[model samples]
Target: MATEKLRQANTGIRSFWWWLQCIVSLLLTALLVMDRAEWIDVPGLQRLEWQAYDWRVRSTLDGQSDSSLAIIDIDERSLFEIGQWPWPRTTVAALIESLFTTYDADLLGVDIVFAEPEASHWQRHWENLVEEYPSLASLPPPTDGDQVLANTLSNYPVVLGYYFQSSVQAGDPPVIGQLPEQAHLTTDSLLSLPEPQRYTANLAILQNGALSAGFFDNPLVDADGVFRRVPMLQRWQGELYPGLPLAMLLALLGQPQIDPVIGEGSGVDQLEALDVGGFQIPVDADGSALVPWYGPRGHFEYISAADILEGRIEPGSLKGKILILGASAPGLMDLRSTPVGAVYPGPEINLGLLAGMLHQSFKAQPPWIQGFDLVNLCALGLIIVVIFPRLNAPLLMAVSGTLLLAAVGGNVWAWHQGWVLPVAGLVVLLLAQTLWHLSMNLLRETQQKRWVAEWFGQYVPPQLVKSMVESGESFGLEGEERELTVLFSDVRDFTAFSELLSPSELTRVMNRLLTPLTGAIHQHKGTIDKYMGDAVMAFWGAPLRDMKHADHAIEASFEMLAALERINREFVAEGKPTLAMGVGLNSGPMSVGNMGSGFRMAYTVMGDNVNLGSRLEGLTKVYGVSLIVSEATAKQAPDWCYRRLDQVRVKGRRAPLWILEPLGRWSTLSQERCTWHAAFETALDHYQAANFESAAQAFKELGEEDLTTQIYLARSEYFLKTPPPQNWDGVWMHTDK
Candidate 1:
């Protein structure tokens, strides 16, 4: 009795401690879920997520960009062969002329901006003559060099490029170009669009002469200092301007039918996709598209401007291809950080975008993706919390490992499918849950061992305590929730038996009956919960955890019945009335703890299922059964033979549950009992089907004196006299326990 009390106390502590860990795990998962949902942003998480994405992109790179896109690189050789920076305006004009006329290029986008007027040798000489003669100023400085380049641009398919800046310096140039109308369009309420403070554009004359112009500025540098995406449009003083790549695409498609597709959300209107010439291109809420990298540097063919100038370029090299003229020389400072390399050339970036537009290949991270990420975090948390508690060390490790791999593999698969997901959040949540479980397991086992050694070493057998401690079994009587088997047993007609004896004699008789029963339960590793007069309640899988809890409870029930028979035989010999015992067993999740007032605490199991076990014990007389068990227990110990009792809605629960009569282990069942079981099931089936007369006949054939069979026979007669409704599903709802 003392050992049992101590066990109850320890079990209560253990259960409380475990639930505390669960609460912590839940809170952690919620935090991560909130982060994923964008309700709360975690610092550094975005960068980490981008880093993970970068690795996936780098590893999964396929073939190079489309063959039609090429770069007209102004490399170091060009600088060396054609003299230093700011070459003659006619030389620049000559390069543009050769691309269209000599190479037969369909389109030419000048990544280099002509923001300032150029001064050729003749023009510089004219300026000197003007200094010598004041009359030269009225001579127009010998037809300035910029005018010559402007004339060249007016006849060709040249689309000039410029950049936008957020801040202005003292000597910063003014906005020079005449931005074209209908270059880009947006709805009136573009409140969240990126707006630039100032822009460096081509000279007004140069812009007017070109086919069109676009901003080469990319304002979407990621936290990792990598250029992953480019803004499709930028706002300047409430006016929308197209990006360079977008301008080129528009040119390619003849500027076909541009339309903004609104996204789904609250009052805010965000652009989700852009339809250009019947081709739909996806973009983020900020109107940026991921740079669809074909591969690393040198992925596209580059022809030297020096080679084009010297007329040494091969024929058909730039024929019918879109050419991007941007510098690749280190001094030019056009190198950019991209997924392919830290020092990738800027021209290749723009070319990759053009290639992606041509091929209709784009990767986008829309605003709705946040919801998917949140759902993933929540789902993984739920699985971890419910499953981790029931697993052994190795199994927990294996399952968590599998989940980690699955998260990564699923994320990569989604990325390849053109979905940009923030997968780091899922990985972080899983890791946190696993680490919490492992640490709590260690702490719980350590505390349980110490607790058991201090309080239970003297009461419990030394070897028992040692084995429990060494095996990391929690032997403390702290209550915890577990899938356990509970048993309830009572003596039939105990009220009448008690009245026939004096109080002392009743006590003696009760002890005589309970002594062997208690021994049977203890021998099967069951903990005696409490004794209520002529009844006893016990449970398995607590005080000491047991995986075979259901089987142990079943064995104990059989032993208790056998013990009661011997006790009845002894009572009969003493001229006292023999007592019959009915045992009930059930298995399910139950809360086991030390519960009671401070003055009188008892270690006990409590749950709806535990109450169901007691209710089953009460129903034993109604069914005329010596032993009854719930389907849950019967399922765990399949080697035991059972008879389907009834589908009953136990008192308090609305759903119906199946009860079975646990006859004996399969090896112990007689062939006659098996035949009876089959016949009994058939009769029960007929009775439930409302074939009352047939069921009655079958029951009479099974046994005339069998209490359960007779009860069914009586019910069949009553139901036949007043037929039940057709919709009745045969579930017997019991109102009393």
Candidate 2:
């Protein structure tokens, strides 16, 4: 019959828990939906924190080192030295010639946009130079120069930079260059066609004609109108035009021909891997590769344009080097905002190209990455589903947290290794799984509480009884414990004080004092275990384990003492009697859990250890000490200095225990007090040795404020009043209860 009753009781408990979980689950679902819809405004400042996390991950993956891409800075110094903005094309041509002839640069790529013609005077000077010198004539002719600089461009390999004009204009045909025989054409070759191609005229006449041409457009858009990624290729007039980086790569690779393979009905355009001499180049859809930007900004090397113009740098420095000319000057309009910085980022597209050349780190979203992502998501989902149903609440929570961390770590690793995994999807999955488990757990716990209350409603506190039934544990509660320092504090004369006020008046007064005291306890992470009529029992290092429990408890005790002083001043002004309290602290192991029967229970500790702690609180009165602690607590608190009082056997304990007082404000102690303490210690030594006269004299010298002074004086007076019989030990017996 008893077994049957127990089984029925458990069944009812489970049912109640299930119902509670259902309600909690519904509430959680609502919250999740609201959050997803952004009905709740999560602070925008959180994005900065997220950015910090991203930076940490990036820093960890990429060693703290600058990139090798050098920037040829057209700084303010260059502007002042080179005669202001838009220095004549001849000056630009000189800058290029100096880099090529003196620096022996391998490739020269201009980041500047030459969208307009040079002045006629500058054009004529270039023509005169070409005519005066045959070698200058050998140089590519300028398209408008009397002798076009295009002649010089043709003699030496050069790549012209231009931007793609998406805007359509009427009455003019777009200019396009003839495709070299080696370059692949999507359609049959035709020298000229009437059909309009989508392109715009180049602003700068290619006086010195370029061997190859590339578009210098960076097309990246962010949620807040910021640029984070640069598109390498964009479609125009039914043809793919490569970005600046791609154009540079091609030029550096000896103007390699590009062959594109169109997959039949797959709608996937693939580039045939090409060999530029010995180097292999990979391109993605639209015949472009993602530029591997090392970071958000300033990853490229920069050289001041003044250094090149004023002969500060050797001209040979540019030899065999792919030199990019861009402005880093603040006054120049070339500055761009990027993810890593607000300052001018130079040109990230150019930086990406330089990075690609140095490390050969090309970006491509291969077909396999999509497959990997799908597999990862499905596997994660399966794991959550299988584990969520079988595990207990605590275990379920632990596993969920672990799995979430693992998933996040995996994503970070993939991203650091140049793979862009979908982080948002994994985060959503984890949230869903956690919410599902929480809903079920809440339902189960509620049902258990109801069953518990029904079984033991008459025997235990309702709160305790509910907790026992829900948790399904009689002794062990779902909590943690550590070596906590327990403190018990009580008013000195509550009985006499209470007799003067009615019950309501007494309660109000008690609450005023307890309010500040409780606030102090919580501030130090100590939980109030229980409260007697005039005493408070609280403990540290449970529910949440803090390694600094001893320190925290001691600090809280001192804070309470200070708060009482404030309270006393207020009470004095209000014509109420001031209050004083004695606090006792002890640190040791004690069984902390739910106690009492199922219907009514309490989260309390019960053991000899707890009794000893209470006894210590009572001992505080005997020693006339504001705060007293046991030897065990004093030993653990190395940071605090304490003076030992007396050793005494309390009412029940057979063994004697050492008592101590904290040395308050040791740094500020007056020299007189220090000397008095020395005298008190001497008296204590003499008293233990049965030298009553010497002990009495030493004790007499101590001031009234010295705590040990009174204890010593009392001992001496007692011995003098009734000299101890022979063989009587120095130990003093307490005559008072």
Candidate 3:
């Protein structure tokens, strides 16, 4: 007998163990599903390096000014007004005369490059036009308009534009121009050895205008190719020369002396810093400046070319103003994509030059921002590894949101204050947290599916059974309390009715009755917790927390009533007794988790709140009502109109519970309901004062359209028939069920 007892005890322990595992698996699955439904939206951390880069550029040139700028727009209007492109050298000459004589422009700068001479056909036509019109003799020589223009440039303070060649090949020579005196001079001859020879610009044009020319090379770019900064100087043929902006600055400052500070290093590591009028500008070892582009495109002043050209501006518009000439024309192919703006205006280089001159806003990289990035990454890693693991869900969410906001806010603040912080890395960090949490949730769900398969196999329908299993525990066996709206519905007199039918017929009728009712509950996203014979117990706002649980329950109640009417109609046609059901709904805190022995666990709710809902269901029939809810449920369901039934203490409860009935069709009966409610309130006051005759008369006068008035009338009649003894406080006791 001892051995037998030991075996039974062991079996019991095993069952418990199995149940615990199953419960744990189910809970984890619930968490996984919740997480999958986007409990958190983790934003990628913006890298500090990129932010710092932005800051440097913004701070350096925030309020700079530009002068001697003119925009030559090849706009649609220009195309329409001047007749398609290649508008003859005479037309361009006319534009130049207008800028010089009419606008009093000090320096003329051309953003347009004369890459190749005009087409032979156009060149011949231009030559013929010049011959026909002797007045056009002042125009630039027309062999190739660019070179002809270049030759004419020597007489004026003209700065021609050229771009740097990024690709190099063997034996290629630099484009011919009047080479600077120290063009081939290198700070370190060995280190400055050209990787390979490369050339830029049309050679003939460069040669013709070599005396007074500048390279229009704007090099500053972000990860996405967009111009934000104009490098002041560049290295070509082992010698340093000023870029267009720097050259313009030099010209503005009377071509001030330029001194180079070279770092003692080997190969491309050798550094150079250009000192112009006390401003020290560092070029990458290769003599390049990555212009810091402000957020996206169009981050600068944009004046229309037509407006400027047509003398639409007042006097002094170009006075001491450093102007830039570039295209905002969409067809110019200068548009670039950027973070802040897509298809940003392509006249960004000219804008940058103007900004640099006006506000001295030049972009530079600061060393400290790199350190800040490392610090940011470490901090995020600590949160993910330490703080996140220990904190509960609410705390975790709060901390994560706070940290993300702080990072983003700090970066934006710094940027507005003219400090560029790298944002890409921070963006990456935030994205990592979001991705990691999602991945972990998916993993947890897979584990849950395995646990569900092991237990509760084939016991319930696949969907319901899966739901039951997925609602289990997390890493450990700890359970949590959640607020849920519980519902208990029962078909009145079902037992008595069942006796009239055989087992087979009873089964068929039961299925027909339950199917539609269950469908109504599911429509409101309520889960069926369990079904006792002829009764259903369901709950909402758990498994998933729905803010609209109260509304959903009320809506489901009305729908269920409608469904019952249809069922009853069928029953009447078949000569079967129609059925009536009562539903009790209450919202309160309950412990919802795995409950039972190890081998036979169920995901269900428990507590006094759950019990109260079931007890209220039983009182529905006694009150002659189809649906009843506690005061708590009625108050929570603000969207639905409810009529108070009475204050009564249910069995096993000490305090009186305020009961309510779902006022279906209340919207349609708005005016009538108002009158009936007012009459019911008066009747309630009189009934409580033991004035049964007055209360009965008031209730009867309410007419019988609304259910609440009918119920009050019935109560008054019952109380009058069996009047309470002396000292009775007029509270009616409902006993029959």
Candidate 4:
């Protein structure tokens, strides 16, 4: 990781990432936005939120059974003891009578609906016998069991349960039996709440006899079929009716009317909660409330119907407890999927809500919940735009984890305060943001590593390239001008030298010459531009900036001379002729960077100074010297002693430039050579001033082996013979490259 070049969203890439994040964030956020507006369905996100809520609900469960509520479950035991179900009305009446009169419970509810009158087959047989023989007609028609059950229900106002259907089936009655009292809330007033289309209710006698009735069916289950919420009231025929829990609660509180607490809006559109007997039963906009689960399902007291009939229950167990009669047997009772688990008893759902209402523990998901989701989404979007791009992968994960913990913590706290605010959308947004940042960072670094490998793989050493990559700065690949030193070198008389060896031998010779020379350049931080046969071209000052390009280039040139002497010794031992080469170096402003066609690219330097360096190399063979340099290179590297060379113009350019010959460092050169070089320069000055006699006499006395002294002596004698020019610059121009 330390070696990786992690690119931040710099100016060149910032706008691209901005729009990319916007597009991705918008696509994810739009689904929730449209869902909140009721214009689309985002079931996946909704399911995620539902599951999160379920986890919270489970984590806070009390895990203790409530003694205040009990169910008279018509389980298999009751079936075995009582003959069969659709139990005789006389027996049902006896059970009801026993619960209230004998056990003395505070309130009771029957989850079973008595939609039809009793069959009384035995009574019909008896009446038929009496009509046929006139023997049993006077037996008082078989005691009325339906009327008996009615009397029991009338004697004590027990809340009865019924159900509504969203769709009516074929051949089934659209409306059966008699419904309980309606709240008379018109459709115009509560348009958000559901309106019932059909119902299966209790008989007229039973309805008139009981305390009241309420619908038990929950139609607003989540898309995943979890019973997370149930409505408190639903609309029907321009009227609102209470749910079973509400009906039971109202009956327990002395039949108080349901006073809905609506907010500042039309049609009770902002339905917050239902006010019943001074209890604030909080609900959502659609008149629904999140189910307040006490614990896992079946966390309540249960007494068997057979036990009630056979008098097996403890006497005080049902004395003050509210009882609801329903079946718990698998095939007989209605089952529901809830947060706790699948296959939950339907009566338990009602009992859960009823208990919540009794304790006022119900939580409201009011109209503003949609607004809260929108706020979370918008907030995360801003974070994506402002903060995400700047963070690396690890930090993105950290931030996402922290936000999830905070959101879940805050949401659970809200739940405890009787409000349900969602954090699922927040989780989705965070995931999107974190993923975008991490993925993009990976891609950017991947491309950058490849780029470094392609451009500098051959020119720079591995460690140096690694350091450059780790610096994280942008490397401009386009050609740019920079001060650099260029070196050009080749074997003297290369054509004649190669003729002395076979092709294979020449290959080995060139390798011997170029290999160590290449090392010398790399050692002094120079770039090897290209090699042409026996000739080599190299430079310094890029793809990295070096303040000492001139110094380093001159140092490399000296190393090359030393390397050639070693090669010559190897040739002498192998019984071959010794060889020598000249190096030319020039430092000045030059174009240095990546340059090439589409097929290939190379890091190199090129300019007029680069060409001048090549010309100086050729001058070395003509002037009896092994090293030559331009004045610019000599000025920048002042520690080396140099001999003055004549000014001359190269073929390509009109400007005449001074060239110098590097002798040795000041610390290494002897006193005798320095004196002789100084004496020769004095004589050359007299010749350039047109004093030919003095310059010729000085050259004759010196008689040095240096080619420049001899060339000047011949030049001085010729100028004396033709000394008629009124103006002469003494600057020489060469026509050769």
What would the per-residue lDDT of candidate 4 be over residues 1-737, giving only the tens digit for each residue?
11121223233464575577667766766766677667897768778888888887888887876788988889888988897788888899999998987788878888888988774665777777887989666567766778888889999869988988877668877689899987533233544787777988998888898889988888898878889999888788767788988888878777766676767643435767778888888877778888889887678887899998899876656888888888887768577889897878888888988988888787678667776777777776776667765655577688778887887788888988867788787877777667777787677656665667666778766655655555555666667899988999988778887898999999998888888998888888888888988888988877677788888888898899999999999999998888879889888999976676655666778889899999999888877778889999999989988887788887797887888888888888899989887888889788878899999988877786778788888888888898838787777888887
Lowest lDDT 10-residue stretch of candidate 4: 1-10
Query: Cα RMSD to native, each candidate?
Result: 14.5, 14.7, 13.6, 11.5
lDDT of 1 by residue, 542-642 (tens): 76778899999999998999998898889889999988888999999999866666576666889988988998988898788899899999999999988
lDDT tens per residue, model 3, 159-179: 555666546567666463343
Question: Whose TM-score is greatest here?
Answer: 4
Each prediction's TM-score versus the true structure: 0.63, 0.50, 0.50, 0.65
Residue-level lDDT tens digits of model 2 in 577-597 = 777789988888876655556
Clashes of each: 10, 52, 55, 1
Query: Could you give me the TM-score of model 4 versus the true structure?
Result: 0.65
The order by descending lDDT is 1, 4, 2, 3
Highest lDDT scorer: 1
Per-residue lDDT value at 135 in model 3? 82
Cα miss at 339, model 4 (Å)? 1.8
lDDT of 4 at 294: 89
Of models 1 and 2, which has the larger lDDT?
1
Task: Report residue 395 deviation for candidate 3 (angstroms).
Answer: 17
Q: Candidate 1: minimum summed lDDT over ten consecutive residues — where?
A: 455-464
Q: Give the worst 10-residue stretch by lDDT in candidate 2.
A: 187-196
